[model samples]
Target: MITQSGPSPDGYDPRADRDLPPASGRGDPHRVPEHFPGVSHHEPIGLRRRLALNRMGTFDWDLDRGFMDLDPGALEVFDLRPDEYDGAPMSLVCRVPPEEGIRLDAALSQALQAGTSSYGAYFRVRCRDGTPRWTHSQGRILHDADGLPYRIIGIVREASGELADSALLHSLQKERQRQTVMVQQVTVALSRALSVADVTRVLTGIGGARRFGADGLLLGLTAGGRFEVIAVAGMGGDVPEEMLTSQLDDTLPLSEAAVSRRPSFLGSRGELLARYPRLRPYGEVLPTGSSSFLPLIAQDTVIGALGLFTTEPAVQSTEARNLALALAGVVAQSLQRATLFDQERELATGLQATMLPRRLPEICGGEVTVRYHPASVGRDIGGDWYDVIALPQGRTGLVVGDVQGHDTHAAAVMGQLRIALRAYAAEGHSPETVLVRASRFLAELDTERFATCTYVQADLKSGALQVARAGHLGPLVRDGARHVDWPEVRGGLPLGLADAFGHDHFPETQLFLEPGSTLLLCTDGLVEQPGRDISAGIDALSAAFGAGPEKLEELADRLSAHLWAEPGSEDDMALLLLHRPAGSGAATTPRLRLHVHQADPSGTAEVRSALRRTLDQWRAGEVTHDVEVAASELIANALTHTESGALVSVELLPDTPRRIRLEVEDRSSSWPRRRSPGETATSGRGLLLVEALADRWGAEPRGSGKALWCEFVVPEMPEASARVR
Candidate 1:
């Protein structure tokens, strides 16, 4: 027996003979430990046997001297003989692989540096026969009083079974996570696919292969008792032409998968070729890897097949097979949804196209071009539409409108409204009347929907445009000099809502489109972005229009490209561009017309201002005073005497001395008679002024009313000013 008070300052050395303080005077080294009472004296020996039986071992490492003492059990854990390991710890380097040794060292260093009392690590060690065995070690760090680690005491154990279970679980977890991510990403992308083409783009676009963790992919759809290769991806070489389209009975992998409605997994390219001898013709071009073909089945119907190729061994694990099936299920569902959407979109678009004019009528003096793009979100079919109606009297009615919803109901309403507006305009109704009737028609539909619209009754020969709006964006005008102007058009409530609210009055805006000018009417979709201001989009549109090509078709295409280049537009767009080419030979006489409503007190002032502006543009400023005075008198007399609006026209008549003609037409058949007025009484002075101011003034029977006309003689304009406008 030996007695020891404590460990040396260098730290405890387990090999040194030591004894616990004598407990109750018992000094037997092999006796039951003092800490264990009422136990047999053989207990200490039994404890050692139990440890050995459990393949548990102990070690004492002297950090300063780099020496380690391993018990027989630890040697067994490493599959090493007692004589195989030298006293130096480095002697075990041959047993532990380089990476494992580095990892163990780093763990121990971290524990020591962080002042931890213990650490544990699992690593692989080579056996005597060069077989790798799993081993685990748990160590207790011993430090000097100054906190410097000088020794380590720990246990080593055989961990093959424990680590094997843990590794399998970890691998399963990792694979599950990868599968989950792949499915989630693919599902999210396909959720937005609105058509067959859109689905193909998502699955075969850039990074499509990486998205599926596959090196190559092939996709085909079954149609008309045949298979069509809709898309192929990640193939390093071109696909054989024969594979592009084949019958269901064809001896092809994809075709068979589709026909059988079951998945097929091939171990390698050779296996695939061996199974399908017909593929030998293109074996050289095929990818060298394992492959899988999964039939895309929806509602128990096989619609297509998807193939995945990888430059690795066969997908043999149950997890891999399950992942492939799950991906196929997701793709199948998406394809089903996209197919349905495609069919519905086609039907809706067909209906919409049928409602619209098959072709824009060829205008006498201007060209009409139109474009329509449906919403890109899901299966939405918007109500946006455009129609070019050839109204009577050589006039053209350009209409662009959008109903309130994005469905067949809205499209139906749009079609009805378009026809109604077209009919009214062709019947020679005023722009304001046409809109009022259209609003009433929509309201009568008895649906909880409304619509916005802009109707322009254009007199190309006269270069006059009467524009009316119902809660729609104003039209943009591009002049001959490439200048763009968004005229301020007064608006009323939208179609159905106007009738519901009892405010169906849509004011007509007077516009003059000189030769070589373009009037662009488009829906809000063209200039509305998700997170940006609509004004900004409108500004951008203006800039693009101002700088666009001169040809109407080219300009429309360019504008469409500029505004709709990016995807994710939530609404449909309908754009109609009416371009009035510069007069053919000599410039047609420039003319301007305006309407003055009797109910509007400000109509007379607005018409007067418009007259001044038009005169200035036409370089007829010399007679602006006489023309304005006579026009004011005529308009006032018509409004005071008649019960309807007045139509005023200012024309630079192309005759000798270049006379300026002013005509005020009234709906009333009552003609104006020149009458002398009492100086004090303000009665019957209109015709007197017209008579005194004009070189020639008279009244004529026009359509359903009479026209009071006056002409002003002026000198010829400069050649530059009179050049073709």
Candidate 2:
């Protein structure tokens, strides 16, 4: 057998006959090839009953799998001959009971799936002495690329004596006492072990750390409810060095017990083998002793499972098993809390997304595209929010705000402030008045938090925009010639800090559509970077917009991609953009004979209705009927499915001598895929219709979301192009 290059565990002595990794494949020349000196040494019960498995068993299974010959008398115990043995299957040499095989198979499968090193179970096998011996068989699985298991080696020891001996139970009753001492030792030593690496080394029995087994100890929570392992004194392999670091979570078996609030027995290795029958091929895969699974229950909850595992067929005495369970319990409690916290965070994220607008409103005067990209990091849902509020007074309320915290509580406050902004705005209040009331609403939020916001109310008639900023980033405006930034209202504080602070009236700033101008409103995530000036981010945005409508989409995508980091950024982001055709001048003073005003909302729903209204007013019959629903669905979809902090714009390209074109702009670069016909899964299918209806339709990234556009030729009016511009 081929042994590894590393030195064997302490006290292991190697000789020329010892098998190493890449063994010669020839049968081992040493008599009774085992981890010991010779057959005679292991034969005498009083001489060397311990397998010296802890000292380092056959290290090179690749070189050879040694099956030492038992005395001829021992072979008579089972009806087997040496000639019948095959290296491919140890089962061919050992007689394992049917139940034992099934049990062990199941265990191996669980171990492999869970990324655990060891899996063991108790089972009965036909012994060479014509006796049925119950034993625990445990194996360690080695994996390679593609996650396939290459080899599994296990140890088996007779457990029948322990199962039947009442006297042995008494002797083992004090196991828990030892476990208690170990827990105290591990806790006090915990401060000394800082990093994950340190923790790993300590778990491996270094620095006075307790050892459940001198051989292969799985230092994890017992499934029943304890922080311990199945103690095997004379076993095999170095105290595993990777278990601490390899674990995804510390709870393990304790979580199981905590959930059930009951003690658990490790399923038999025979059961494990039975479930993973293929593992049987690795060794005379059978059970050695019954194992126990303890749940680590904490605060009335199961955080993980702890396993007292072994390769012995007979169940250990209740006392020993309980000791294992108890030790595992302590470790489990801490791990469970951590896992529960992570779950809560995920739930918070879901709720935050739901709170944001799922769909944007549809407008007819011009096409408006919107995209929102959320930040890549944070513990829970963030405090950023955006809204499309259609006021009763003909103006559209575009608002975006950021609460001061990044948790579920922050999210709740955001929702409250959001509705209040709309309620006051819908009640005929101007953007400045709405901000004043919204500030008051936030001040009573029950928590000391601040909120910053930018509110804009765009009037369609004069193409005039009213903007109010409350301690938020300046607005970016691109008016044909160059990009311009609107400064803050001078003296304003983040909301909720003081009553008088919110009482200050925000000065409203108004600017005309300014011919080919574009307005960009976004959260600070768009401009803030650690150790970098805000101008750097602002410069990036300006440069992309300055490139004009031709490169606008591509540049937007590139910029958005740059914002995401590997370890991720700290805050949630919100970006909203409104672009009017630069030279063509959307909603600008008449310039084209037929001007098609792009009036669509940031979302897909309202955009479609607005598109249909425009087509109907122009008297395009089937053209309007055919794509009304399609346009609505596609445009609404553009609002969702991608990052929320996206730059979205829409354009109305009048077919100069013929048709009117409708274009939606966004930064998402992924090609829209079609799901199975009529998938109700809430994300696909919209793109399918866009492909079929529009003339020469395709997508390119806008500032953030990808623009999905289509063209429709109108025939009725000779001046149709003239009517659109």
Candidate 3:
């Protein structure tokens, strides 16, 4: 054996090494050498054999001397010869990469300082051949009798394959987490979308473009068997107008995607050009590198298609495609719901319009105008209506009502209630009696809906108004100075609720309208809003009413504009305004005038012929036959009842709706009573016949002579004819 002197490259003295007992045998290295402290002298041969079979490298370290003894396998792992690296632990430490060498030194130091039994560290080491390998080193530390560290025996193994597998698994898990979060966020947003436009804005917005790496997006929907561009994003003014407005045929890619109900990809400009050569001339309008068309399918039906364009072809990945497909499914479902709602809303609105009054009746002292606004949210159809009914004796019935709920059922119920109210009022019922009968009728129908209504019957000649309310807002009255005031009116329960609770009495409040006063009747929607009390809306309405344009139509427009300036209201509004003009008498120049003697039955015929000619001249020939029959009845009654001959007068009242007024006067001071005639009685039906033929008819005492008068609402004349006379 050779005796090395001094430090031997690891600062180990050869004199100290010689102090330990010699090895048992060269072939049996398993026999613990005296210098290796942690090894047993009688160690099992199986442990040493197993380590050698698996090709694990082993080393022994002297803690006090700072020296290492490497086995032949250990030296082979470092790619060094036994002569070059044997007993040189410093050289072995130098072979490790700098950072890993420091880590290994720290582990050994910790084990020695703490007097621990084991130490382990994993790090990269560079072999003498300049190859890097990941390694895990584990060792056991032994102490001397004085409790000072003496030696360490350890084994090292390669761990490169295990680390690579762990790293791949971690990356895959992170990507899965990210995808799950994205899908959840998109699902929540799509659920809240209320309309097709709302869905389109969310789909092509910022979040969508970033996730799919799309430069532009286009949405096409199938309508009437043709593809139409419903929405677009990121396409600037460069896109042609034809692409937006014109319908697409089956040959187009969008139509193909919808027909096939599958996603299709256009990989390159050449692919697009090959299929759609017509788009080649507008190259800039097309995507640069790639495009994808996805079918939006819901419940096994294709409703539309989505198109995405990207500048780089490689940006379209499998993950992005799957995400797009999932989003398309969400959009398809939401759009289907929106489309059905829109169709139902339109039908409800049409039915509601038919139920409302086609034209407001023009009264002698007041001008009537109306405006209706549907709800701004959801289906947009609700139960709000206004009407002007011409009652007997030159009185007008003003009505505004709102049925509960904003649905088809509510609208249907509103129509029926309006007709019932008009019929009761036309049959000479008082304001309070009309509402009581209407409530009973509504309850009998069993529609399970309630309604709030306000009805006002105004005597135009006397300016006396009788108002009855059924849980509705009282009318706003504007004075001569345009100061608005809400009159005190006691209200009963809503229509259906009154009969349900055994309460049918609706009290009437009488109001005298001064000349130039304006009466406004409106549904609750006009003065009610979410998050704001109805009182606040009432205040705003009062302010709007005070500031008027003086013209009835313009004032109506102004009221609607001011009330609904801010949108998102979920109620329908109906407003009716009746402005009584300053003067209360007849016009100086009537459209037509006739005078006849009532005694001669032949005079009735003469008066009828003269009335026909005058109505024809006024372009009101539509009411000529009705007016003539009414005149004949009134003149016959005057001749038969009164001893003196009567004066027959026919004058057309100048108003928006032209009126033909027929008055027959006799010296007798008797008023005609509308008697109930039996089915077979022909004589007592004369006054009843006149009432049925005329819009309004009654007998008024004029000084000593009683004037039996009736008014017929004639067709409005053209602008040129109205201006003529």
Off by over 4 Å in 1: 1-165, 313-315, 584-725
What is the lDDT ranking, best to worst? 1, 3, 2
The TM-score, computed over Cα atoms with residue i paired to residue i, of candidate 1 is: 0.64
TM-score of each: 0.64, 0.38, 0.55
Error of 1 at 396 (Å): 2.5
Q: After superposition, how far is residue 522 of candidate 3 from its true place, in Å?
A: 1.5
Per-residue lDDT of 315-411 in model 3, one digit per residue for the tens?
4554445556655666678889877877777777788799898877667767889999888677757889998999888899999999998878888
Query: What is every candidate's alpha-carbon RMSD to the true fold?
Result: 18.0, 24.7, 24.7
All models: lDDT?
0.79, 0.53, 0.72
Model 1 scores a C-alpha lDDT of: 0.79
Candidate 2 differs from the real structure by a C-alpha RMSD in angstroms, to one decimal, of 24.7
- True lDDT of residue 230, candidate 1: 90
Descending-TM-score candidate ranking: 1, 3, 2
